[model samples]
Target: MQEKDKLNILRHSRHDWMNVVQVIKGNLQLDRKDRVYDILNEVTRRAEHEAKLSDLNTPDLAYKLITFNWQWQKFHLDIEMIGKPIDCARHEMCWLKFFDQFFEKLTEQSDSMTDPNLLVSFHLQETPYIEFDFQGGIQDMKNMQEWLAEWKVSSSCYVENIVANEQELVFVLNKK
Candidate 1:
């Protein structure tokens, strides 16, 4: 990534942090202490998730996900880390390579006019797996599914697509 792109990501992250602080401040001004506490708890929960994601020992994967919002994609990306963090150093490349291709397909097949979001959750505890939950429209649905199936067949990871259609595409990947 270029230095400019790196700076842009920092700017975006800073904006989000500012928004959080503003919300908290606004609630305090309104004397809504309960709402302020709720917001703080949510912010702390999200921070914990981010810390767990960083603890996975997958720097490339972490960078890809952390900077995903800076890219030119139609959908917003949300990355979540669930359960205890596990060291995934041995499988970082495999996971990174898979997402590199998967993201391409997501952008190429997605509808640019619609506002959609993709939630990617990393289940890192026992029976670890990655979940892809996309809510949006895909232009070339068949091609996307074929690409996923091809990758699954050729790769060591196991993939199960629960739903693949125009409105949504949900799948899970687990190392074998």
Candidate 2:
């Protein structure tokens, strides 16, 4: 199958899964524990299956690597930023794609880690510039290098490391 086709399937699968979750959540608001648990489990199973299908010979291997990392961040990390709007949704989309690529590289370098527990902060000023700061494991030091390299490839924004301390990595981003 074509790469775009596979990506579309993955995106669709996620959308459907979210829809199902929303429905189940709505039903559970009536205090239907049994139905909620059953639906949640089924949804999770299907999501995992679709995720596997999406991973099969994925064209953007970079995307696959960072997929779980982004999932992890979505589940565990806190993000905050301040910036004037410049294609807010598009900028976010750009970041999402870039981060998927960046985090995948980071994950590969942190092979020994089970949980890197990195603390991240983002700051976006005017135009399209933003900054990111990360703190935690030694693994992050290596990850930061790849992040910088990947950041250089983007046309949406310019990224630069303002600080690479023993415990934190700080980066700034601006419009290209």
User: What are the per-model C-alpha RMSD values against the true structure?
Assistant: 3.0, 9.8
Model 1 per-residue lDDT tens digits across residues 1-176: 89998897789889888989999999999999999999999878777877888889998888778767755677888888878899888878878888988888888888967788899999887657899999998998888878878767756676786688779999998887
TM-score for model 1? 0.82
Clashing pairs in 1: none
- Best candidate, lDDT: 1
| Prediction 1 global C-alpha lDDT | 0.84
For model 2, what is the alpha-carbon lDDT of residue 160? 67
Report how far off residue 73 is in candidate 2 (Å): 6.7
Candidate 2, TM-score vs. the true structure? Answer: 0.43
Q: lDDT for every model?
A: 0.84, 0.53
